[model samples]
Target chain A: MQTKRMTFPGKWLPFALLAPQVIITLIFFIWPAGQALYQSLLREDAFGLRTTFVGLENFVRLFRDGAYLNSLSVTVVFAVGTTLLSMTVALLMASTVNRMIRSRSTYTTLLVWPYAIAPALAGVLWWFIFNPSIGIVPYMLEMVGYRWNHRNSGSDAMLLVILAAAWKQISYNFLFFLAGLQSIPQSLLEAASIDGASPFKRFWTIVFPLLSPTTFFLMVVNVVYAMFDTFGIIHTTTQGGPAQSTNILVYKVYADGFVGLNLGSSAAQSVILMVIVVVLTVIQFRFIERRVNY
Target chain B: MVENRPWANFFAHTVLIIGVALVIFPVYIALVASTQAPGDLLRGTMPLLPGSHGIENYKLMWQSGVSTANSPPAAKMLWNSFVMAMAITVGKLSISLLSAFAIVYFRFRFRMFFFWLIFVTLMLPVEVRIIPTFQVVADLKMLNSFAGLSIPLIASATATFLFRQFFMTIPEEMLEAARVDGAGPLKFFKDILLPLSVTNIAALFVIMFIYGWNQYLWPLLITTDPNYTTIVMGIQRMTAEENPQWHLVMAAVVMAALPPVLVILFMQRLFVKGLTETEK
Candidate 1:
C-alpha cells in the first residue's frame, strides 16, 4: 500500500536481475504453451508434422469424441476421490499426532517418509503388491478365499489408482495441518475445556474453524496435484488399460500427442485441461481469499 | 492441567502405532523383496524376512545389463540419474533465489506482472505442453542428452514463489542497514541475505533434488538410447521385457528409491518446516 518513487536506482535493478528467469520461462513455458494453442487450431498428418489450418475443428471433434468425454468423467472421479480421502486421512493423522505426549517427531518422520520417494517408485511398489501373479495383496486375499484382481476390474483399477494417489498425498496435507494445529493458541482450548465442553465439541467448535484456512489451501493444491502430477503412477501401473478405465485427462493428453500422434486433438485437450484448472483456481481464490485471514 | 489419563493415552498411542505400521509395511516389503534370490522371488515364497542374496541379486542385475548398454553396468543409469538430479537442483536453486530476491527486495514497475507470469507457469501442467516442449528440445538437438533433462526444468515457479515468501519474512531493517553501510545491491545479497537463507536453501535443495530424481515420463520420452536411460526408465523397461525378473526389478527400485528416502529422513524437520512455510 506504500507508494515509492519509480526512479529509485534499486527499482530497475530487480527487474534487470529477473531477466534470466523471465527469458527461460518464456522460451520453455510460455512459448510452448503458445505453440500448443496455435497447433490446436491446425491439422496434422500421421507422422505428427503440422500441415494446415483447421480452425476449431479439433475442438469440435473433441466434443463429439466419446473417449474424451469418458476421460473427463474419469479424471473428475479420480480427483474428487483422492482429494476427499487424502484430506480425511490427513485431518485424522494431524489431530492424532497433536495428542501425543512424546516421540511425536519420530512418528511424524516415519509417516511423512512415503512422500519423499518418487511417485514412480511408489507406483512400482504398489504394482508389485497388487500384481495378480505375484502381488502380496492378491496372495493375501486368496489366502482368505477371495479373488482380488485390480487389472481386470474397472472399479478395482480406479480404487488402486485413488489409493496410490491418496497414500502419497497424506504426507503433504498432514504436515500442513499439523503445523496449523501446533500454531493454535493453547489458551483458547483451555478456556473451552473449563467451560465443560466435551472433547469432540471443543474440536468442532474451536480447533476445526481455526484450521479451515490450512484445509482450504491444501484442498486447492491437492486437487491440482492429483489432476496433473499423478500421471507417473497411472502411466506406470496401468498405462490407462483395461478399456481405458484409468485414463485421466493428463494421461490422455500424453497418449494422444506422443503415442497416438494426434497433435491437434492433444493440443485441444491440453487447452481444455488448462482452462478447467485456471477457472477452478480462480473460483477457489475468489471465495476462499475472503475467509482466509492468515 | 489435568493429570494424564491412561485409557485416553492408550487409545491415542495404539492408533498412532497402527498408522506407523501401515505407512511402513510396504517399504519393509520392498526392502525384503530386494534381498531375495530370483528363484525365491519368482516362487513368491520369501517371507517378510531379510535374505542373504542381496549381493548376488545386485551382481546379477549389474551383469545382466539391466541399466546399461550391452555389457555396461547398471551403475551407468545411477550416474545418469545423479547427474540429472544435480543439474536440475543446482540450476533451479540459483535461478529461484535470484528471481525471488529481485521480486522481494527491489521495487520496480511491472514487478507484480512478472511475479504472476512466473506463477502462471505453476498452473500449467508439464503434460499439457509436453509435445511442443519436446519438439523444442529436439530442435535444440538436446535429445538424449543431460541438457535436455535439466534445462527446461531450471525455472521452477514453485521454488521462486517459495523463495520470495522466505525473503519477504526477513526484516526490512536488515536490508536498509546494509544499504546504510554503503553496500551495493549485489553486495547486500551476497553478504547479508544469502547467509540468512541457509535454512530455506537446504529445504528447497532437498525438495528439488527429490523432484528431479523422481522424474520418469520426461526422461523416458527424451532418451531413446538405452545407454542414456535413467533408473525409472530402466525399471519400466525391465517390467516390459519378457521373463522380467521381479527380484532384480525390485532391487533396482529400492536402489533408485533409497537416496531420496534417506535424504527425507535426515531432513524430516526441515521438510515439514519448508512445506508449512509455503502455505503461510
Candidate 2:
C-alpha cells in the first residue's frame, strides 16, 4: 500500500493506465465468476427450454452425489501424493547439489530445465515410458514378474498421473529447496559439527528446522498446483479414465460442465473451487508475510 | 573448515548423479523414441539408443503431421504457439507495467479498490470457472482467434505485483529530480521508469513466455479449429489416435518442448529471479 513520498499529480493518467487491466478483468474474470454464481442457482432441462430457480439444490445434490465425493477424495489423494513425492525428491537432490560447490551450477541447469516442459508434454513423455507394452519400465517390471498396465488398473492409472505431475514439479521445488538450503547460516553447521554431531544429526537438528518455512510455503504451492494445474496431465494421459481413477476436482469440473452438460452442478463446483482457491491464497499470503521476517 | 570427509563427499556426488539421471530419464526416452522408426517402436520394448531415422521422423512431423489425427502440421502449430505466447507476454507486461507505475507514482481515488480487484485474479484460475469463461468468450465471438487465445488470459495480478514491488524500491529522489527538470508524468515514466524496469521486464517475459507457450486448457476449449491449435494441445490430438505413431508423436513432442526449454537453459538466471521474486 506504500506509495512514493514525491508523487505525480495526475487525475486522468492513472485511470488511463488502469483501464486496459480493469476492462479485461471485468470481461474475462469478474463477469464469468458472476455468471458461475448465478447459474449455480438455476437448473435447465435437457432440452434447454425451461430454467427454474433451485436455491442450494445443486450444492446439496453434490454433497449427496457419490461421483462428486469420489472426485473430492481423488483430488485429496492426488494432491498429497504429488506434494510428498516431489518435495522429498527435491529436498534430497537440493541437499546433495548443495554439497558440490564445483558441480552445483551444472547440476542445477540439468535439473531445472524440466520446469519448462508443459504438463501435457510431461504426461506424454511418462506415458510413453510407462506404456505397458512398449515402455522400458514395464519391461523391467515384467522381468520381476510384476505387470504394469495403467490402461486397466485403477491404481496404476493413479500412480502414472501422480508420477507425471510430480515429475514436472520437482524442478520448481528443487530451486526453492536449494535456495532455502543456501540461506541457512554456515556458522550454525560448523558449530554443530564442532559439537561432534554427525552430518545426519546436524541436518535433522539444525538444517531441516531452518528450512521449515520454505517447506511449508512449497507445500501450499504444490498442493494448489496439483489440485488445479495438473488438468493438462490428466487430460492428456488418462482423460480421467481407468474408472475415474485420476479425475481430480478441476478435471471433473470440465467434464461435468462441458461434456456432461450439467450446468448447475458444474457451476456449483466452480463456486466451491473458487472458495477453495481464495482460502488457499489467503493462507499462502499469510505464510509468506511471516516468512519475510525469517 | 570444521572437518573434511572424503566418504561424505563421494556419497553426495553419487546421489547427485543418480538424481540427475532420474530427472533426465523421461526426456531421454522421448528423444530416443523420436529417432526410431515406427516399426521399431511397435515391435516390443523400444531401443535405448538413438535410431538412424531421427531426421526422417522429425521432417515428417514438421512437414505433415499424422494425417490420421486430423491435426495440422507441427510447423503450423509451433507458429501458433509462438504467436500466442508472444502476444500474451507483450500484453501482460505492458499492461502490468502501466498499472504498477500508476499504483506507485500517482495518488488517486479508488486505487485500493482497483488493486484488490486485480489481486482477486490470483485466486481465480481459468480451470475453476471453465464453462462460464468459455461462454463469455463464445458470446463475444472470440473463439478460434488469437484475441480469444491470449487476451482473455492476460490480465495478470502476479506480473503487476512484481512490477509494483520492484517500483517501490526505486528512490523517491528520482521522481523529485524528474519533476525539477520540468518533466511531465508520462515523460518521466517513458524515460526514467521504463529503462529502470528493463531487467524486471526481461525476467518476467521469460517466465510469462513459458507460461503462455505451455497453456493447454484454455486453447483447447476456445480453439475448436485445427488451424489454431497450439503445439501443446496439438500433441493431445495426435495421441488421441487408436494407435498413435509413437515416432512422429515423439518428434512433435520434442519440437513442442524445445523452445521454452532452450529459453530456460539460456536465460536461467532471469527465469530463477522471476520465479523466486514473483512468488514472494
Task: State which candidate has the highest TM-score.
Answer: 2
Please identify model 1 stretches exceeding 4 Å from their true place: A1-16, A45-50, A283-294, B1-3, B44-46, B62-72, B107-109
DockQ of 1: 0.55
lDDT of 1 by residue, B1-280 (tens): 2235678778878888887787777778888887887778777544679798889888776656563322235677788888999999999989888988787776678887898898888767677788889898899899988999998888888788788777767777786777678888888889988899999888878888888888888898999876778887788777766666777887888878888889889988777766665544
Q: What residue pairs clash in candidate 2, if any at all?
A: none
Cα error, residue A22 of model 2, in Å, equals 0.4
**CA shift at B147, candidate 2, in angstroms?**
0.5
Q: Tell me the deviation in Å of residue A109 in model 2.
A: 0.6
By lDDT, who's the top model here? 2
- Over A1-294, each residue of candidate 1 has an lDDT whose tens digit, in order, gives 222222125756787788878988998889988988998999877675548999999999999999999998898899999999999988888888898857778778878887877777777778887778777888888889978787789878888888888888888888888888998898888898888887788789989999987778788888888888888889878888768988999999999988898888999888888887787678666655664556
- The 0-to-1 C-alpha lDDT of every candidate, in the order given, reads 0.81, 0.94
Point out where model 2 deviates above 4 Å.
none
TM values, all candidates: 0.93, 0.99
Q: Encode model 2's per-residue lDDT on B1-280: one tens digit a residue.
A: 2478999888888898898899899989999999997799988977999999999999999998877898889999999999999999999999999999999999999999999999998989999999999999999999999999999999999999999999999998999999999999999989999999999999999999999999999999999888898999989988889999999999999999999999999999999999998888
Range of the 10 consecutive residues with the lowest summed lDDT in candidate 2 chain B:
B1-10
Candidate 1 achieves a global lDDT of 0.81
The docking category that best describes candidate 1 is medium
